[model samples]
Target: MFFFERAIAKQIKNGGGPYFRYIDDLFIVINWPVRHLLKQIERLNNFDENIKLKANIGSFTNFLHLYTENRDGTLFTAVYQKPSYEPYYLPSNSIPPLHMKKNIPFIMLLRTIRYCSTFQTYLSERENLRMASLLNKYPNKIIEQQFNNVLLKFNIDQPLTINNYNKYRQNVLDSPYKEPTGIDYDKVLFIHFTYCSSMEMFPLKFHTLWSKSFGESPINEITPVLRIRNVKNLQRRLTH
Candidate 1:
């Protein structure tokens, strides 16, 4: 992927438009004629038999979960969900520990913030999430409080700044564990922590037992695990 991107970087830059790619997904903003764009696509496809380029040229398109519309000279974007999407969330009464339940709303809200580009979009998506919660038998007041808490923490105001909004998301989602600088790893002990209602002592004991069982490497070599919940797939159901 790196080599292919490098090979085409010059061509794309000289094409007189913006081009961005994430992994294998390519997004090109072009002002050229359709025929010219088609020719370019054809040329790209012919460049490598193993790599085939599938191109879609339009004023509106879906890319990486964002629905984008080129209106006049401006671009408008909103969250895009597949037609088969079915909203579902963790039920309030689930058997998991209390901490997991507490974390659920904040995580969901964080995702809502990341995906929705505008306040209206956020409200619409949030309402859909609330409806899902309702289906799961979560209390309306509790859900509202949780939503408000997230908004308060983020200081989110109307007419959102999409770019700046995402900056603090990682901090909200994951607590950092600094790895030691110098360490040799013979074996890696990975501790996966999820929300637990129990006191801090519970994790401490669990960590002890885990270390006893697997043995521990120096903290420096251990990579901190950051779990970011992705509800996109959970939102969809198979249409059978």
Candidate 2:
């Protein structure tokens, strides 16, 4: 990908528009004429037998999860989901870390806010998110609180103004993502299981056994953490 991108970067830059790529997905905004651009793409596809380019030329397009379009002279963007996209989330009543449940709404809202250029678009996506959360058995209070927290963190007011939206979106783009902290794999032990009401005391029993079995050994120094490998809902099961 590095070599392939570099090969075409010069031409794209000379086209006087922005170009972005994340892994194999490429989104290019260029001013080349239709025939010229098609011809260029044809050459790129034939450049390698293993690589093929599928081009869509239009005023509106979807790339990755972003729906971008030209509205009058301005470019607008919103969340893009495929026709088969389903609103599936981790069921609130299911087993998982509390942090995962809490993080879902806030993180999803942040993604929606970043992609939506207008307040109306953000509201539309927010409403969809609210519905999805409800279907996944999440309490209404939790969703409301998470959404409020996101807006508060980004310094956005309700019924967002055009003036405020511009600033809010800028902050989203300008903010740098956090680097992942390194984990000490040797000092930690992970136990994966599917939780049920019957096994409520199993964790405590296991810990007690661990202390008794390894109390005087060096293994006792390691920490044990429980993890739910995965939860299969109807939608995921059907799809898989």
Cα-lDDT of candidate 1: 0.65
For model 2, the superposed segments whose C-alpha errors exceed 4 Å read 1-6, 13-17, 47-50, 155-163, 197-225, 231-240
Q: Write the per-residue lDDT of candidate 1 for residues 83-130, one digit (tens) a residue.
A: 887776677775455456666777677677665555567778777778
Q: How far is 39's C-alpha from truth in model 2 (Å)?
A: 1.0
Candidate 1 ranges with C-alpha deviation above 4 Å:
46-52, 89-104, 114-118, 136-142, 156-201, 204-240
For all candidates, the clash counts are 2, 0
Q: What is the C-alpha lDDT of each candidate?
A: 0.65, 0.84
**Cα shift from native, residue 181, model 1 (Å):** 12
